[model samples]
Target: MTSLLPRTRTMFPGLTEWFDAAWPFGERNLVRIEEVAAEGEYVVRAELPGFDPEKDVHVAAENGMLTISAERQARKEEKGRSEFRYGSFSRTVALPRGAETAKIAATYHDGILEVKVPVAQTEATGQIEIPVKKD
Candidate 1:
C-alpha cells in the first residue's frame, strides 16, 4: 500500500541512527504532566500510556513536594520494534501554599494519573463597600 506520508528516513537522513543510538528503536521515554488548581483542590495529571498503575507507577508527597514516576520494561519479543522507550520517568511538582498534604488523593484512569490535594480554606473576614462620590 502506498503511504501518503513521506518516508521518515528521507526527511531526516540521520534521524534513524539518532533514534537507535539510545534505544533499539528510536524511542524517547518522555513523561508529560499538567497541574491545575480549581475551587478547593489542586489537580496534577501525568501521562503514562503503557504503564500499569499497580506496578509501574508511584506517587509520593513530602516536604511540600509531589512526585510522580513511571517505569516500564519492554518484553524480550518486543525489543527492536518501533515503540515507546523502555525506561523510567519522574516528575516533581511544588505544592502550592496552603496545600493540605494529608488530604491528598490519587487515581489513575485511561493512561493518566491524577492526584488531588485539598487546599486550606481561606478566611474571608468581611466585605467592605466602596464609597463612591456623587457628582
Candidate 2:
C-alpha cells in the first residue's frame, strides 16, 4: 500500500513558504509536491520553475525511497522586487510497498516535473499461517 501522508519538511507548520518568499534568506526545505496512486502506477509531481531540468534536476530511488533534488543559481543585478527562490532544494518520499523502483520514469515540462513509478499488483491468497513455539 502507498502512504498518503506528505513528507515535506518546513521550519514552521504552515508559514515557512510565506517567510521564505518574504525574507529570501530562511532555511529552505522540500519543494511542493503532489502524490497520486493510479490503478497501476504511483505518480508524483513537483513544482519547479526557472530551472533547467536537464542540468539542475535529479531523481533517484534507493532503499524504498524516492528523492528529487534541484539547484538554481540566483540571477544577478536585479533592482526591482523579486521573490524567486535560489540555491539547492531537495525532497524525499517513501515508495509504496509494491513500487517498482527499477522501472521508474520522470519528465519535465512547463516548469513542472512529473515522476511515474510503476506498481506491482499482487493478488490476495486469503489465507494466513501462524507458528507457535513453546516458551
Candidate 3:
C-alpha cells in the first residue's frame, strides 16, 4: 500500500500511521504486534520492551481470542513536564478462522513475544440432513 504522505505533504503525515504511536520522548507502553501466516500456521510477534515475562506479562488464548497483558513499574521521576505512562496494558488479537487453538504456543525472548497456531484441517465428509420437524 502506498502511503498518502509520499503523494501529498499533509500537515500530519503521521495521521495515516497513527497506530505507530510515540509518547513522552519516544517512550511508549503500548504493546504492538505483527501477525503473518505461513507454512500452514499463523505466527504472531509482539514487542514489550523492558518487561519481564516471569512477573510482568501474561498470555492467554481462549475461544479464538489471544490476549497479552503486562504491567510495568514506574521507572524515573519527571520534574517539570511528564507524560504519564500507563502502568498496565492489554492487547487482544482475534485469531483467524481455522486456528488450532488447542495447539497454540507462546514464548518471550529479547523483548519480543512470538505465538504460533497451526491451521486446523477444514473438511466435510458429507452434508448434514435437516428435518423440518422439531424435536
Candidate 4:
C-alpha cells in the first residue's frame, strides 16, 4: 500500500506570488544617475558605490557624445545567496552646440563620478554682405 502527500503548489500559492512580485525576471538593482549644467561647463554625476577606480570606471567622448560607464561588484556575502545583483551601467549624453570635446575631463571621488565638459565659445558677429539687384 502507498500513501499520497499534498502537492507543493497547493500548499504555498501565496508565497509563490510574493516571490514573483518581489523579483520579476530576477532583476537585482538599478543604478542612479544625475546631470547638471553650470556656467562654461556641463557636469554629469553618477552614483557608483563600492567600485574600484582603476578597474571599474571608464569615460569617453566621440562624435559630440559623451559616455560614462562603470561596473561594481555586489557585496561578496550576498553575491550568490540573494537575488539582488548589481552589474555594470553605461550612460551617454549628446554634447551641446557649443560644447568643447578636446577639453573634457573627469574625476571620481567618494563614490560619485563627476565629468566636466567645457562649453565652446561663440564668435563675435560680423557685418553681412547683401548683393544689389535691379527691379
Candidate 5:
C-alpha cells in the first residue's frame, strides 16, 4: 500500500482551500531595497528579478525625489496553471541633503539595479557682525 500523506489534498479540502487563499500558488512577487550612504554619495540598490532592461525600466528625478520603476513581462506558460503573473514595481525615495541631481547615475547588472547620486556641497557664507555702542 502506498502512503497518501503528501498528495492528500483531496482528503483535506478545507486545509487546501485555506492554504490557497492565504498564499496563492503562482503569484510570486517581491522587491528588496537597500540604501547606503558613502562619504560623497548616496547609493540605492533595488532588486528586480526577471525584468528586461530595455523596455521595463524607468528612472526619474523631480521635486527632489528620485523614482525607479520596473516591470516584467508575463510568461505565457503561467496562464492557467498558476495564479502568478508578470510583476511590476515602482519606488520613490527622497534625495538626501547635498545630493547632486545632475550627477546621478544608474546601472543594472545581474538582476540588481544600482543608482548612484553625488552628494551636494553647500558653501559656507561669511558671517556679518554689527558693532554695538553704549548709550
Candidate 6:
C-alpha cells in the first residue's frame, strides 16, 4: 500500500511550491476536446458545462488551425468545498488537409460544443504509376 512516485512536496518543499506556482492548476485552463472523422467531414467535440454558448463560447479557424475558447465566471455565492472550475479555457488543433474553412459550423447542446468542419475525403489506391526515362 505505497505510492510508486516519490513524495516531492515533502522532500523538497520550495521546489514543489515553485512548480505549483508555475502551473497553478496543471491542465485546468485547457479545454478538453475530442476529434472524430465522420463521413466526408471532420468533427470536434468539447466538454464545456455551465457556460452560455452564445456569450461564453467562441470558435475560429485561420491558417489551417481551429481554435475553441470559452470563459466562465466564478459564482459569488457562498461556497463549501466546491470543485467546479472557472475562468477562461482554450484549445487549438490543426484542421485536416482538405478541410473547408469557410463552411465550418458549430452547435452547442447538452453542455457539449460540437464543431463540424467539411472535408474532402481522399481515397488511396495503394498503387502508384511511375514514369521511367531513358538515360
lDDT of candidates 1 onward, in order: 0.81, 0.83, 0.77, 0.73, 0.76, 0.83
TM-score sort, best first:
2, 6, 1, 5, 3, 4
Candidate 3 Cα misplacement greater than 4 A, ranges:
1-29, 75-84, 124-135
Off by over 4 Å in 5: 1-29, 78-85, 123-135
Where does candidate 3 clash, by residue pair?
none
What pairs collide in candidate 6? Answer: none
Instruction: Summarize candidate 4's per-residue lDDT along 22-118 as a digit string, tens digits.
Output: 2445542244567788778888887777778679889899988988777767676733556444778777788876888888888889988888999
Worst 10 contiguous positions by lDDT, candidate 3: 20-29
Residue pairs with clashing backbones, model 2 = none
For candidate 3, write residues 57-98 as lDDT tens digits: 898888889888988887676666544445898888888788
Instruction: Summarize candidate 1's per-residue lDDT along 6-46 as a digit string, tens digits.
Output: 55646864555465344555434377789899988999988
Residue 16 Cα positional deviation in candidate 5, in Å, after optimal superposition: 13
The predicted structure with the larger lDDT, 4 or 5, is 5
Provide the global lDDT of candidate 6 against the true structure: 0.83
RMSD of 4: 10.9
Give the TM-score comparing model 4 with the true structure, all chains together: 0.61
**Per-candidate alpha-carbon RMSD to the true structure:** 7.5, 9.3, 7.9, 10.9, 8.4, 6.0
Query: How big is the positional error of residue 36 in model 6, measured in Å on the Cα after superposition?
Result: 0.6
Kindly state the number of residue pairs that clash in model 6.
0
Q: For model 6, how does the per-residue alpha-carbon lDDT over 1-135 read when each residue is reduced to its tens digit?
A: 233445454675445434534255455434779999888899999999888999999999999999999998988867575546688889999999889999999999999999999998778669898999999
Sliding window of 10 residues with minimal summed lDDT for model 4: 1-10
Worst 10 residues of 6 by lDDT: 13-22
Backbone Cα, N, C clashes tallied per candidate: 0, 0, 0, 1, 2, 0
Task: Give TM-scores for every candidate, taking all chains together and pairing residue i with residue i.
Answer: 0.69, 0.70, 0.62, 0.61, 0.64, 0.69
